[model samples]
Target chain A: MSAQPAAVPHLEIDGVSKRFGETEVLRDVSITVPRGTFLALLGPSGCGKSTLLKIIAGLETQTGGHVRLDGEALDGMPAYRRDIGVVFQSYALFPHMSVKENVRFGLDMRRLDKAESAARVDEALELVKLGGYGSRMPSELSGGQQQRVAIARSLAIRPRLLLLDEPLSNLDAVLRKSVRVDIRELHDRVGTTTVMVTHDQEEAMSMADQVAVMAEGRVLQMGTPEAIYERPATRFVGGFVGSPPASLMKLSRRFEGGWRFGEIEWQMEPALARRLDAIRRIEVTIGLRPERMRLVEAGTEGALAAELRSSEYLGGERLLHAAVGQERIAALVGGHLSGLPKPGEPVHLLPDADAVMLFDAENGERLDP
Target chain B: MRSSTPLLFLLPAVALSAVVFLAPFAWLIYASFKTQGAGSLLMADGLTVKNYARLVADSYFAAAFVRTIGLSALTTLLTLVVGLPVARLIATGSGRAKGLLLALMLVPLVCGALLPSLGMIHLLGPLGVVNGTLKLLGLTTSSIKFLGTTGGVVLGLVQAFLPLMVLPLVNTLSRLPRDVEHAASSLGASPLRVWRRVILPLAMPGIVAGAVLVFSAAFTAFVTPQVLGQGKIATFGTVAYQQAALVLDWPFASTLAVVVLVAIGLALILSAQFDRLLRRRRLAA
Candidate 1:
């Protein structure tokens, strides 16, 4: 509805919706990706994140609305003419093709001159650190190597927009990190506009410049990764995009001074108080990130009382578990933090007030300033 | 090195195969080399290659060989042309549609060779479906025919062997990952190109398997062409039946049977070789 901007978005999905028979897969969803930016659609399974990506790629048609590239509506175009690329989760490499052949297929489809196509194929394989893997079949390669081949094949086409569905989900945890870095490096080198869909919050937080959180066929929020984390627009967005994820506490009451969290009536941080426009609202659920809370000795000054439930050693940091009233909270601390607490031991947790988030208990909407 | 116990477990099946398949096949091969005789299934006189030589020299048998091979090949090709799209449709169809399509394809399979032949006669004979429709429309002509011709036999064979082609193709095509096709389309390949490059190459095993099944079934098929051809086309099966029953030249009939079997065997081997060559050229991991 807005007038065409000076610089048209690299890819704009406006009011896109899809329905399979009676079941709505994606509601009216809109997102605009700027050029040379990596965007991620993050959500749990059945969130319609993959469907949204497929719609943009023209792999899946939308029942309503349309997609635009550089301000030009791609309404009637087939996926083959969309000039987008996709890396499916299965890698989906042609088993009957060599890595080089797989990469060359797209270029061949484009009908580039043989020499230029070969050069581009080599360049793409090299870009994915698969320079010598050209003649190798997909089955001959490891899972990570095969994934690299898929990425190489997609990137070789130099698509207008690149869509990757759960790009790193098929890899092991350790390889996921390495491949994640590889993908970031590839994106930096190519500077292509890209969108990836993932269920892993950490993957989204680390890899994407902008993150769109979706749930149940609707996009809940879209912002820079940092903003999406620190200032989530909805309770689902807040709860869906964190390592331990921001915890939502149902049991809270306002005292004469401030709201009570779990067992103790605590004072609110001045910044958080200023952030909440509905400051007078009580019976609200607060989001406390696990890493933001600190553990101290029982009855410590300026800290609420808690009972230690358990503790888990997580390499560099220990994730200590404890219960304050009926709600369970986890606090990340170092080994040097007093030799770690044992289960059933009494303790106190001091949540960093600035890190605490407030939301309406009924609708799960953020009640921010 | 692993276990004789498991080998012991295979005793019944091995004995059954030896008696049921190997014994009859061995007897047939022996009978092919025997001297010509009347009223005997067993080999008589000394084994000789004279009957095979006569079979090769006889232009009648030669024409029959050529006709059978050419017609069977055409039937297999037509089966592929018709069955591939149907298999793909059934593969990508909804649950109920898929079940219905599968059930329909199974009709020919369960109908057996005899029933389809009879049905083809009713459908394509002189006063059958085609001519009857033509007559109703006032388009019937003396020059035109659907049954009692080589083309009719080909049609009948294709119908008979179609399920053999479709079943393996559906099994393979349905197992293909949908993402690969999506990947190809997104990568700027047209739908046709995707079929040619990605879908077809990946479905090679199914194609080869289906072709073999269809080719073998068509080559050995007796009832369809026999019924539909109405004595106008004499395939290897029909001619051998005549030589055995009417002429009672058991040795010559056995010779004809053996030659046709060899031809079918060669066709299968050649098809497999073609598949292996393709795999080597495009793939071979």
Candidate 2:
């Protein structure tokens, strides 16, 4: 279910800005995660997504801004008092502690009765499917198992908000998929406000109901996964969110009734031409997803000529890597296609007219159609 | 042959150490069993257990042994209590602060036992800087008896060997991930609870290592105890020094030295056993 903003915000990170000396790590970033929403702060390294997560978890203090949990301002609250559970990228399981002890740590801090604590530990471990691993030390578990134990440990606390920092990054590819599913299912069952920071686009798209795409210390876009994928607000978001990502090329020259990029020409519709004319931009960037463009025979009419560089087989589909001038673009063509060019051969790409996105060349912001 | 080649290469060093070090140690053990004829410094022909018998029989030596053990234990504990925070600061601090703290910690270590012990004299002496400051501040009308006291000797020993505790602690604490503490905190552990549950448990190896090192150092320490004790506080080391160098009863002194060496060796073995026990599960895992 989609989280509506009209509902009371379970976690509100308002204008949180963090600076380490002169370097601004997070610049006035803000996000409101509604109750029971699984939100992903998706970005590459040094994008301030992890920093924002830390600020919310109270592991770090924001140089400026207020973070409120259930409308109560969490300013000056130590991480212990924040009642937030953080599952670190490394898992951060106490190596000296047994799985049971690690899970019971928060309960022990609460001074819960032995029977109650033991029951809680059992419940948490069962949730993570590690029911019989109580007496084992953290060092005894596999990476995936350790990750689950970390999740179990955090869940044992029944924390108000749960923050996961790149939770599945350490796991193998196969384990990552399974663990990702487990985490999503756990979140659904737990129904706690969850925020996961990850550089993985697919992880965000698949697991999160809401995804906030971040870049260069700023939130570029925040919406449902579909909205983020279908309509990225900036060129950065457009290039970042897709698999075999969208090919972006800057087009400058304007011909008779279309835009010209070196030897390639994109004929504009009458309505689109009027919009472009109104903006009066000499240079504009265009984005095209790999699946939206088809590989045609060289010298085809209205097709952009490209030099085929490589091809990768992907079972039912093959990816064609081609270069149009200096810009490299890929086409996800069917493996059963009739014609496929060898590396270094000339090819033509025919793009779907309606799927093309226009962006401002200077700022990389998407221009409205 | 290839594996044995490395051992063959190690032969020279082993042989040199055996000749230079083990030979003297063997003689020391042998001498501990011999005794001198009356009014003579030269060792007598037949071996006797009188030296060890004297050590076991004398209540004075027993008291000295107990006092020495107590002082060493006290020094070990004091250094641990004081060094834990300093080691943490060095481990967690960055850039200039870390470098500065490390350099400060190393200064006394490089200065050696005698120099720092001398420095401690000025700091803890009755008419020294502390007493002078106290007198100036009108805190006391008379000088406190810091010199030739158990407290004075222990203070000197702790000051001399705190780096022993801190170095191992820093090595361990630095390797300890900050995330572990954060996880504890995030799991509803207060700062104190985090220390008790996570930090102290993880730092056990460092604590044991530092304890052993500081204990061994203080147990056999001569210069600091002798200088700071000033002949009034009779520790095992001070008594050993008095017997060997001042009393000139080489055989009796050698027996005392052997006792110290045995005690230190036992401590090492005990600590090694502790380490093995801690590591058994880890190795199996």
Candidate 3:
């Protein structure tokens, strides 16, 4: 669309839509992945992230629109001919085939010569750090090993695009972190245009170069992980993309100089007040991220009166639960800090003014400054 | 103590089978070794190998044995080819279609072999639906021979035993995750190759199970062959029936029955060995 700007995108999804009987599973979703970029379609369950991945992989056909790779339209190409590899959540290894055989299957389909096929199988196994595990059956391996084998099998094909559907969801929590790092490293080494669908924000943030946050069959925002995290396009994106997600509080009537949040009328900076004046709506939602807010003395200026309810020690940081008016918000404090307020005691929460976000109360869309 | 309780729960079933099934089978085996006097139908002499000797010496019995084996094999293959799609439909299909297909499949089994075989008579008789349609269409001037033919008997047997193949196939095929097939296709295997490399190999256990059931059912089936064969075709079932009921040679008939049972046992053992060999082949490959 940009008149051959730079290199063509390795994978392009153009206004794709999918409908299953009466239910619309995906609606006008589109994204493009530059070659070698790892993109994660991040969303909660039933968000159509997996459906979009399946459409890209050619595992499922889209009801409307087109998907292209390297400027070539792949509308009617069968999955087998698309040269896209998919690693399913279950691993989906041929229980009958050994590790080497499973990896060699794609090569066999291409009718590659035996020696080269065997060599590629060995190369793939080595890449996944399962070099000596060729003889082992899938059932014989642990969950982590099986997942690695699945990745190896997909990589052995040397596909133009690689799709993973919640690859680490089936693993136990302990193995998930290591596998997550391994997948990112593998993507880097292989340099294939890869798309991974996951609900785990940490996995998406740590692994993918670009993250697309989706909800209710539509993509809300698509950008670099930092961009999505720092400047979320919608209130849902703000609440969905972070650990201890940003808390949203309703804003009341505007006072003499600033708006009222909860029971307290907090004064706003002149620059921030000017931005709020742009929106004509009386009702607005303010987003305060837990990490961006801190505890201050009860009588501190420009701070909301709150009561400390509980604290959760998380190794290096402690998450404190505070109640202000009818709303409850959390703040992360240093674990080493001593003499924190006891539960039921009144405290003050001072949010970083620069980091504060405002959203339209009616539609949940972020109101950009 | 844990084992004893299971045995205790199994006692009635084992005892019932021992009384009703094992006792009759034992008697049949015993009778196969006994022979009647030359003039009387009643047993007169001690145990001997003459019935078995007579069996080995008879070319007619040998021909019947070969025919029955061929028929059973053909029936098994046909049922597999036909039942596979239907079983897949049942396994993957949802709601009323699956329930209806399963219920339809069970109709033959529930109706008993005799009823279906009797129904087959009207379908495959000289003036049956097929021949009548052929004649009415002017494809033939006269009715084509169906009764007392191998093809007719095979048809009847297939209709009767198809559910045997489908039930196990559905059980196994349904247990297969849809992901593996999707994975195969995404990994560059064509639809045909997916079936060859993934689906069929995985469904081998079901295929073996279904084949054993169908093959054994077809091999020892009586009513279908008797009613459809119309006395011209002499399968093991029909021949045994003839010797037992018409000729009234109980010892010789028992001998035939014993041989059929042994053949079924041998088939089961061979299939079990085949399963082991298949596992070994997969491992070694």
Candidate 4:
């Protein structure tokens, strides 16, 4: 049974800041995590995402401000006292303990009776689908199995908040996909407030209910994955979140209520047109998702003339690379489509107006489209 | 191909071991059975058990054997008790502090056997600095006698071999996975519990190796016991010295040497078994 629900937010990070000597690692970062939600702190490496996770877990103390869980201030509280479960990137399972003993460690630390601890250990192992491996040593198991033992060990305590730091990074590509789904399922089954730190954008988009994009030791944007991918607030987010990265090109306004780049000119959607009006003829960067660019027949009037550069056949989808003037761009095409243009062949590249994203060239901030 | 190249290089070492160690040990066993009173042992008057019987009948030899074993056992135990905490501190302490402690531990090793024994005698003698300090502190009225006792010999032996016990332990403990300790702490285990459940079990191999080295060194120790024991406490090595040099009984001394060899061989075998057990447990964990 759950304890009485406290009045405070399930997890509240207030004005958290951290500095390692002269280097400012995290600056006044804060977020409120609702109970039973899976939140992913997604960023590039050296972006302070992992540092913030450690701060929330009490493994690393903040230089300023505080963290609270269930109405209790967590400042000065050691990691164990905070009653949070953590799965590190390295797994960190005790090499001297069997899978069973490792899972039961937290329960034993809580002074649970032997019978109760054994049952919980069994349940935890079953939760991670490692029930038959109770007597095996950590080193004897495969990497993924060792990771499962680590997860089971953390879950044995039934912690209220689970903190995971790139928990699937150590797995191979195939294992990472399956383990990612397992982690999401585990989160759903426990219904515990969870925060995961990861540099893998797809992992965050697939596993997290909400994604917090971080860069340069600060949170640049935080929203659902749809918001993060579709309407990224900063150029960094737009460039970072998508595969083949949203292509950015310099564009200027034409006199006839459309945008121009190189030899191409096209009418913009009215909503996007008004947003570009503020900057009028001044040059700006336009972001087009790979899926939003298409190859049309040459001399299609508004479309830009381009030359095919390269193509990669990726099982279900073919990634086509092309050049429009001096700007290199990519388009994702169906893999089964056979009439592909060869390298150096002229083609027409057209942009989907609704999917176009505009940013100020000087600062790379998203324009208000 | 790569593995066999190293094996070929190891052949010389194996051949040398067969020629040097095994051949001599076989010859010693043969010599132990030869008759030796009337003439040279090279011309044996038939193989006999007389040397072994003489060794058993000698009371002084028996006392020395028991004393050597007891002293070695005590020294090993004391070294373990003292060295384990120091080694753990060296392994886990801050970088500068660990370096300083390591340097301090090496001082006795640099001083070696003779100088440190002389230093100990000066400190433990009747009118020595220790007695003078005790007198100044009003802890005693007269000097306390420490020389000519087993305690003095043990103190000397421990000081000489302390680094042997600490270094191996520090090496192994320092290499232990630090993540294991953090995992235990994050699981709500206390610091003492973490040490008991994680650190000590992982460090058992180094502790066993240290114990064996300390025991063997103490068993064969001559100079420190000679200086500090003041001719009162007899050990197997001292008895062998008396037979070979002072008494001029080469056959009897050789027999005593054989006994020392057997005792040391047994101790090494037992220590090896302990090391294996520790290794297996580490792997199981």
Q: Could you give the C-alpha RMSD of every candidate to the true structure, in order shown?
A: 3.1, 2.2, 2.5, 4.3
Label model 2 with its docking quality class: medium
Q: Candidate 1 or 3, higher lDDT?
A: 3
Better of 2 and 4 by DockQ: 2
In the order shown, the candidates' DockQ scores are: 0.70, 0.65, 0.73, 0.46
lDDT tens digits by residue: candidate 1, A50-99: 98888888877899987999888987799999888899999999888888
What shift in Å separates residue B71 of candidate 1 from its native position after superposition? 0.9
Predicted candidate 3 versus true structure: per-residue lDDT over B173-209, tens digit per residue? 9999999999999999998999899989999999999
Ranking by TM-score: 2, 3, 1, 4
After superposition on all CA atoms, how large is the RMSD of candidate 1?
A: 3.1
lDDT (10s digit) by residue, model 3, range A1-369: 123455676788899999999999999998988778899999999999999988888888999999989899998889999899899999999999999999999999999999999999999999999999999888889999999999999999999888999999999999898888889988888888789999999899989999999998999999999999888888999888788888888986665546876666756556657667788668788788999887887666557777889999999998989887788888887888888889999878888777778888889898875
Interface RMSD of each: 1.7, 2.3, 1.3, 2.0
Candidate 3 segments whose C-alpha is farther than 4 A from its true place: A1-7, A254-257, A262-264, A267-274, B1-16, B132-142, B283-285
Residue-wise C-alpha lDDT for candidate 1, range B1-285, written one tens digit per residue: 478989988999999999999998787788888876446655567989988888888898889888988988899899999999999998888789899999999998987889988988888877788777887888756525877889999999998889999999998999999999999999988989999998898888899999999988888777887888888898888889888888887777878877777877887799889988987876554
**Residue A42 error, candidate 1, Å:** 0.7
Residue-level lDDT of model 2, residues A1-369, one tens digit each, is 456457557788889899999999998888988888899999999999988888888889999999998789998899888888899999999897788888998899889999999999999999999999988988888999998899988988899888999998999999899889999999999987899999999999999999999988889899999998888899999999989899998887565656767666655445556666777788888888898888776565557778899999998899999987778888899988765789998888887666677789999998974
The residue-level lDDT of candidate 4 at A333 comes to 74
Lowest lDDT 10-mer window, candidate 3 chain A? A1-10
Across A1-369, the per-residue lDDT of candidate 4 in tens digits comes to 254455567788888889999998898888887788899999999999988988887778899988988778999988777778888889999877889989998898899999999999999999999989999988899999999999899888988788898999999999999999999998899888889999999999999999999988888888999999889888888888988688888887666657776766654456666667865647788898888877777665446676789989999998888887678788887789778889988767677767878777888888865
Best of the two (2, 4) by TM-score: 2
Error of 1 at A85 (Å): 1.6
Winner by DockQ: 3
